[model samples]
Each structure stands twice: as C-alpha cells, then as structure tokens.
Target: MLTITATLRCQGGHEDVLRDALLDVARHVAAHEPDTIGFFVSQDLADPCIFTTYERFADQAAMDRHNTSAALARCFATISPILDGDVVLLTGTELSAKT
Candidate 1:
C-alpha cells in the first residue's frame, strides 16, 4: 500500500473553508477513485487551522492517479489562496495490520 500524510496550514480564519474543501475532496476520491483505500481529514486541536490528510492507496499507480485527478486539482486551487504555505506531504510505508 502507498500511504500519504499531508499537513496543511491554512491562513487564519480560513480553517472552515479549508475543511469544507477537504471534505469535498474526500467525497470525490471515495466516489471516483477505485484504488483509494482510505482518505481522512482532521484538524489539530492546538492549531485549528492546521489540517492533516491521511490517505491510503492500493499502489504507486493509484497515488499517481490521485495526483492527476480533477478533484485534487480543484481542491488545490480552492485552498491555495487561503494557505499560509505549501502543504507538507510525507510519504511512508504502512506498517500496521488492517482489520
């Protein structure tokens, strides 16, 4: 499996917008991307504007497909203007067993 974790810091007061946009992205991925095993979005309690995305894909190709997806592009465009900086993406192996 391919796992991607992204930390995004939104500009102050833009947290709600970012959260909504991320929810849309998650819905789109779940509906259209067959290889997407899971996609989750969460906000940090210490920094409400800081959002994190945990994504799991079937393989590298699945991840690649997500990068090129229109939904992802739209999500980026929607959130770019309100972001404090570039999203921090961390790619790693999934070591935990799945239920």
Candidate 2:
C-alpha cells in the first residue's frame, strides 16, 4: 500500500473555499477510483486556512493513476490561486504491510 499526505495552506480568507473544493475532489475520487483505499480532507481547528488530505492507494501504480486523473487536474487548476504556498506532499510506509 502507498499513503500520501498533503498539507495545504490557504490564503487568508480563502479557507472555506479551498476546503469545499477539496471536498469535491475527495468525493469524486471516492466514487470513481476503485484503487483508492481512503480519501479524507480535514481542516485545522486552530489555524483556519490550513488543510490536510490523507490518502491511501493499493500501490505505486494506483497512486500514479490518481495523479493523472481528470478530477485531480481540474481540482488543482481551480485551487491554485487560493493557495498561500506550494502544497507539501509527504509519503509514508505502513511498517507491517506489504506493497
């Protein structure tokens, strides 16, 4: 399995808008991608514009497919301007799980 965690900081006053857009992307992936194990978008309670997305895929190929999906491309295009900085992507390994 492969896990990806993305942390995004939204421009001041654009938190809600960015959060909504992320939610839409999450729904689209969940409904259309069979290899997606989990997709979650969340907001930091103390820092309003900070958002995080946790995703799990079956493997590296699945993650690559997700990156090439139309839904994600569209979402990135739409949310680019609202971002405060570059999105931070963190990869993780499940210590007990096999790829």
Candidate 3:
C-alpha cells in the first residue's frame, strides 16, 4: 500500500473556504477513486486555519492516478490563492495499519 500525509495552512480569513474545499475534494475522491483506500481530512482545534489529511492508496499506480486527477488540479486551483504557504506533504510505503 502507499500512503500520503499533507498539511495545509490557510490565510487567516479563509479558514471556512479552505475547509469546505478540502471536504469537497474528499467527497469527490470517495465517489470517483475506487483505488483510493482511504481519505481522511482533519482540522486543528487550536488553529482553525490549519488542516491535515491522511490518504491511503492500493498501490503506486493508484497514487499516480490521484496525482494526475483533474479533481486534484481543480482543488489546488481553488485553494492556492488562499493558502498561507505551499502544502506540506509526505508520501511513503505503508508497513502497517490499524484497520
């Protein structure tokens, strides 16, 4: 399995917009990307403008498909202007999972 984690920090006034956009992306992935094993989005209680995501893919091919997906491109297009900085990301092979 392949997995990825991402952190996004929104510009102060755009927290709701960024939150909704990320949720929409998760919904789109759930409906369209069967090979995406999981997609989890989270918001920080201490910092409303901060968000994190954890995603699991069946394999590298699934990850590649997601990387090139139009939905993802659109998401970036929508969020880029409001982001405080570049999204932080880490991708790696999954050695274990809780479920």
**Per-model lDDT:** 0.93, 0.87, 0.92
- The reply for model 1, stretches above 4 Å from the true place, is none
Ten-residue region with minimum lDDT total, candidate 2 = 90-99
Can you write out model 1's per-residue Cα lDDT over 17-42, one digit (the tens) per residue?
Answer: 99999999999998999998999999
Please give the lDDT score at residue 63 for candidate 2: 90
What is candidate 2's CA lDDT for residue 73?
88
What lDDT score goes with residue 97 in model 1?
A: 54
Give the top-scoring candidate (TM-score).
Answer: 3
lDDT of 3 by residue, 1-99 (tens): 899999999999999889888888899899999999999999999999999999999998999998898888888999999999889999988899899
> Candidate 3: where is the Cα deviation over 4 Å?
none
Q: For model 2, how does the per-residue alpha-carbon lDDT over 1-99 read when each residue is reduced to its tens digit?
A: 789999999899998789888988888887898898888898999999999998898898889888898888888988899899999999986456433
Q: Give per-candidate clash totals.
A: 0, 0, 0
